[model samples]
Target: MVLKTFGWSFAVTALGLVAAVLYGGWTAFGIVAILSVLEISLSFDNAVVNAGILKKMNAFWQKIFLTIGILIAVFGMRLVFPVLIVAVSAQLGPIEAVELALNDKDRYEELVTDAHPSIAAFGGMFLLMIFLDFIFTDREIKWLAWLERPLAKLGKVDMLSVCIALIVLLGTAMTFAVNAHQHGGGHANKAETVMLSGIAGLITYLIVGGLSSYFENKLEEKEEREHEEEEQARKSGKKVTAMAVGGKAAFFMFLYLEVLDASFSFDGVIGAFAITNDIVLMALGLGIGAMYVRSITVYLVRQGTLDDYVYLEHGAHYAIGALAIILLITIQYQIHELITGLIGVALIGWSFVSSVRRNRELAAQEALGEKAESHS
Candidate 1:
């Protein structure tokens, strides 16, 4: 059972370990181990969010996520993506960027670090959209009833999330942009760059989100039509439980997941530089962490954990919101990874406890009712 469920994760980790040991000796192995743990600790909430989406996809797509998708997450995001960022931002060719990373680690790190403000802005805005949309939308059940109720009411306003996110981005940019100018030292363009980066992020969220939503809706409609036809053809009434949304629908969902993963990786990649300038070490460490997260995602789906813990989704989104805010703040300041990881884990831990308490209450009520029925 363990192998069937977590085999891919184990395989990926083994490969990553071999690669790490081959490329770097025992000392590098230790650093990779530490970084892997750091990433996993920081991204537990990310795994929850991923499971929420992954469960909605078809089984074929789910397998793809584990197999082909893992390759993208590990190599594409953890490795090539960083090099691409440096190449674009530093105006160097890909070969030169790789060369610089291998030859001049400090300079490469500086180039990556220099781009932090924009990276933070883009990722913050994108993730902020995800959080705001979730909280503001109408839901029959409320997690934090007192807090969520008012937010739901506010959701009546057209595009409330978009407006609020834009206002926050502009406000932060204006405030910090000025501070960055004086203290930032030769970084007078920080404000403009931050604003532009935020806008870019907002645009990315809308485009990707809009496309995914459109495809999902169309797939739903197609399924509904097929169900109706099948019911009509049957002499007796029946319902269709599964859907066959295979091609375009799957592609859009795949796109959405990749983008979401990229957004999550931005913080990790930036923070990894703080620990090590060795690109190979960072990739190997984070790649192992990525595999475990994906395994946890599949486990959550198969176990139906989301259904069991109703408020867990709320907690994950709240964590994402907190991370988004942290990213925005880090635009002008350097926040330690430990602090960032702690904040996310704390919120999720509280939510899990709340879910357990609620479950026990429900169970006790059922037991009491069953006892009364037996007596009657």
Candidate 2:
């Protein structure tokens, strides 16, 4: 299984390298490969979170996620999205934007740099909202119910997230909208443009994120019902066989994985912007990262790693929460993407080691109990 997984990753990595070479020569290809590893290393937590979602998916959708999802990550989000952002923001036609990117490399870099603050703001706020929603919302977990009880009593309010987003939007607007003289000879109007662009990005995130959350919740509820049904079937002495692929369960699972993938990709895509404004390079690097993440997800499902590492999912979610906060703080500070990635990796790695150690201790305890019974 390990070899098969590695083979798949190797093939994709080779293809990425070849594509980079064809487009931008050996030097460019080398750069992309390095960046890809950096992205993968930084995004290990993403893989863990993705694994939690992918496990609930049926085989067919999981396969689709690995195949078609790669296309979306590599081309749609990484390459096309940036181009679209540039064209729309710079008032250049799509053709003109592409021409500038392909011909005027320096200009392309400048455009992307100019657009970074807004992109960061959008991604940061979107992720923050996700974290806050997750914390406050009730889940099936009994413990969570107790935790959310007070929050729920406050009424049907997701107002905190909304209010936070509004504050961010207002601060951005004010920072950019102030007069130049009042701001001490700075380009007030330009700052305002960046701020307003960020506000637009935040609004876009809210819309998309709200839709994603709604669908995710519905799918999760459906999964819970199926699980309950299976349990009841088992109690009645019926053979509760797993359903075939591509059923209602499978479709919901697919949606769940897609949503999870999007969430995990948020940081990676944003971080890719920090490396190179060349959409091609960003695509190549982040595509490689996405492939590795998918491969890791598949391996976890096949091996039932989540069952073994019980705390792994918890750790990943915690890391996501931390990352969301970090991204928010970064809006006003020069927080490095590498730092963010490394911190997430460290936290997840610690959890993984702890899980392994705990498993070993349990096994030892069980063995000792069996020996004691035999002696009696």
Candidate 3:
């Protein structure tokens, strides 16, 4: 299974390399390959988190994630989104902005840099909400139930998340607004725009995140109830059919994967700015990022690694929380994304090794029990 999964990844990686060479040269190929590995390492947590959700989805949705979902990741979020941000911030038309990006690379970089405030604000808040919602909510696993209880109690206050979001909004407003006057005359207006953009980002996070949380919770509850019903049927000696996803469930899964990919791509897309403003280079980097994320999803599914690492989901959520905070800090500080990616890879790698050791230990214990029983 591992070989098969790796075979597919190798094939995709090779295809990307070849395409890069054909389009640009050896430099492009090398860059794409390096960026792909970097993205894959950084996004291991994304794969684990995706597996936690994907297990609830059927095979059809999983395929959609590998197919149509890639389009959104590569083109929609990675390509068009950045251009749109540039256009909106620079007061240029979208087509003109894209042309400028494809032609005048220097200007493109400047525009993207200028637009960083909004990008950081949007991606930061979105990831923050995701991290907090997962951390604060209860899960089926009881390993962290004790920690969850306190958070749940806090959440019972009706609008804890909203209140926290408001504080973040105000803080961003004050920081940018206050600093705006230090630049110059027109610079002050720019600061107001930046502050307002930050608030807009926060508002976007509240709406999308709240709705996603609602649906996620509802689906989880429904699954639990169904599981209970199945257990009852088993107790009654009746055959209980396994629940399979289809139709709307598949659609929802696709949507979930898309959103998840979007979140993961935020860092890579933003970091690509440090490399080159050439849309082609950006696409190469982002495309490689997309390819590896898709490959990781397939790797998890094919190897059934999710079944082995019970704590893997927990680790991923924690990593997501860390990434969120890192992104927020990057707003003011120059946080190298490579550091963030390396940390995620290290954590997930540790979890994987620990899971393997525990599984081996369990197998040995079982073997010892069998041997003793045979002697008896």
Candidate 4:
């Protein structure tokens, strides 16, 4: 099962490293390898979150995600997205942006860095909305009962999550973004750009997430109705057909996953500049890491890991919330990539440990109940 899931990732890693060496010798190879590790560490939470969504998707859609989706993630987000940002921010034509990326990487990196405020704002707000919606929603399983219970109660208020997200966006734009613009020697419209970008993010979240949820719920309802019909037919000795969610639902979920991936990649794309300005190497490295993330998601779903470790999704969402706050904070201050990676790992690790303990307690309770029954 492990090889079936991760075979391609391993092969790609091997070939990518050889290509990296051919491109720039061992030094390039080392940098690419380091960047790959960095991407994986920073994005481990992303794999967990992705697993939660991907589990609901059918096999065909999952294949599309692993194949075509990887291409978009590697090229579209890692390469083209950064260039597009530079082009828009620096007022360069698309061709000129690509030329700059290929010829004068320093200037390219500078423009990308200059554009960080907007990038951070947009990605941060989008991620913030995700975290808020997740935390606000009521679910049967509660990883942090003390916190989640009250939050769920509060979630009864209409649009509470959206309202909170907007308020936080405004607060950050006025204070942190403003200070960043002035103190960082940015243009007069820096804070305004941040504000607009954040609004764009929020709106994007609403449209994409809303549509995705709508279709997913529809699919679930369809499945449920079909399941009921199947059960009735079975009881009556009638033929029962299989349940399948249609392609349209999968398509929207695919769109949502791509957007979610792009939001997660914002920090990594920017942070790669701190390591190296070689965009080719960044694509190769980040792409390798992305493949591994996909593999992990598949493994989780196939193994029923999420079902057993109930709190993993909660941990991933909390990590995402932390990452969103960190992205917003980065509008004014620089944070180490290590710190970001560590926080996510720590949260997930704690959750896994807690899940194990919970399972053990459940076993003990069941054992006690059985022994009592025997005595009686």
Candidate 5:
């Protein structure tokens, strides 16, 4: 099972490392290795969340995710997306941005870092919406019942998640404005930039998430209708076909996954510069890590890990929430990537332990009931 799941990831890692070593020797290889580890550490929650979505997809769509989706994650987000951000933010052409990245990495890094506020605002708000929606939805299983219960009740209020997200954006924007005012410089443009970026992020989430949910609901309804027909057909001694997610639903879910990956990658891309500004090494390293994440997602789906450890999904969402808040906080203050990665790992680990305990408790109860039945 391990080899089946991780074979492709391992292959990619070997090839990527070989290319890195050939390009810049051992130093490049080492940087690539570190970057790969960094990406995986930062994106473990991403894999978990992805598993929850990908399981609903059919085999064909799942293969597409592994193949085409990996390409987009590696080249689109890790490579081209950053450059696009630099080009638009610095008012330069795409070629100029790429040239800046290749020839003047320091300037490139500066431009990227300078654009952090807006990036943070956009990605932060998008992730915050995701976290908000997850916590607000009523679910039978609640990891943090004390908090989730209240949130679920409050979720009944119309657009509560959007409202809260907007309020957060407003508060952060105001804080930025206040800081700029106190500094008494021409830095107030940052406040406006952050405000606009946050709104854009929120809107992007609404459009993408809303469409995905709509199509998913339609798929479920169609499944239910077909299931009824299949039952009737079975009663008539006819063979019933298996059900899979429809094309439209799968496409939207795939789009949602890509956007979610982008939001998760924002921090990693920016944080990677702290280690190395070489985009090639970063892509190679992060690309290898992306493959592992995809592999892990597939493994989780195949193993039914999420179903076994019910609270794992909750933990992943909570980690995403924490990461979202951290991104927003880093707009003004510097946060180490180690701290970011640790928070996610710690939450996931704790949830896994909790799941084991819950399982034991459930087993003990079942054993007691069986004993009573046997006695009777």
Candidate 6:
């Protein structure tokens, strides 16, 4: 199972490292390795949230997510997406942006860095929605009941999450504006840019999330009809053919996943620049880590890990909430990537332990009940 599951991830990681060595030598190799580890550590929560969604997909859709999805992730987000951002933000052509990245890396980094506030605002809002929705919705199993219960209660107000997010975004943007005016010397207010990006993020989430929900509902209805037909056919002693999950639902879900991946990547990309300005090295390293994350998502689904660990999803969502807030704070200040990564890992780690404990208690109760029944 291990070989079959992780062979590709290992191959990709090796290939990324080898390319790094061949291009930039041992020092570059070391940098790439560290960046890769940083990406993985920062994205464990991503894997957990991905597993929560990926498990709902059929085997065919799941394979597509692992295969086609990885290409989009590595090339699209890690490589092309950054260039696109630089090109658009700096009012330069894509070719020019690439040249800037290769020849004048510091300038490249500056353009990208200048774009950070907008990126943070957008991604932070998108992720904040995911965290809010997950926490607000009632669940039979909850990890941190005290905190979660209150959030869930507050969730009773329709659109409360969006309302709160807008408020936060406005406040953060105004702060950025103040800092930019006070410090940037005659530059236009940066808060407007941040606010616009945030609004874009909110709109994006609604459109993507709404489309996914609509398609999913349609798929559910189709499945119900097919199930009823299959039951009737079985009653008539007829063989019912297997049906592949329809493409439409999976397509929307696929789009949703990509957006989610982009939002998650924003922080890692910005944080990586603090480590190294070499876009090539950053991409190679983060791409390798991304491949492993994809592998972990598949492994979680295949192993039924989330089903076994009830609190893991809650933990991941909570970690996401922390990350979203961190992203917002990053607009004005530098938060070490180590602190960011540690906060997420700690939450997920504690939740995993809690889940194990819960399992033990349930097992003991079941065993005692069985023993009493036997005696009776």
User: Model 3: clashing residue pairs?
Assistant: none
TM values, all candidates: 0.92, 0.76, 0.81, 0.94, 0.93, 0.92
How well does candidate 6 score on lDDT at residue 242?
A: 56
User: Which runs of model 2 end up more than 4 angstroms from their true locations?
Assistant: 22-25, 136-270, 273-275, 368-376
lDDT (Cα, tens digit) per residue for candidate 3, span 5-99: 45655665677778888878988877776677667777779878887776666777777777787788778987898888779877999889889
Error of 4 at 83 (Å): 1.5
- Best candidate, TM-score: 4
lDDT score at residue 132, model 6, on the 0-100 scale: 83
Name the runs in model 3 displaced over 4 angstroms: 1-12, 140-156, 176-242, 353-376
| Cα lDDT listed for each candidate | 0.85, 0.66, 0.69, 0.88, 0.89, 0.87
Deviation from native of the Cα of residue 327 in model 3, angstroms: 1.7
lDDT of 6 by residue, 332-354 (tens): 77789999999999999999999
| lDDT at position 182, candidate 5 | 12
lDDT of 4 by residue, 1-376 (tens): 8889999999989998999999999999999999899888999999999988888788889899899998998889888998898899889999999999988998888888888889999999999999999999999989999999999999999999889998998898888887663223454446788899999999999999998878878777678888899999999999885454448888888888899999999989988888998888888888888888889988998898998999999999999999999999888888889999999999999999999999999999999999999999
What total of clashing residue pairs does each candidate reach?
Answer: 0, 1, 0, 0, 0, 0
- Candidate 3, lDDT over the whole model: 0.69
Instruction: Tell me the deviation in Å of residue 339 in model 1.
Output: 1.3
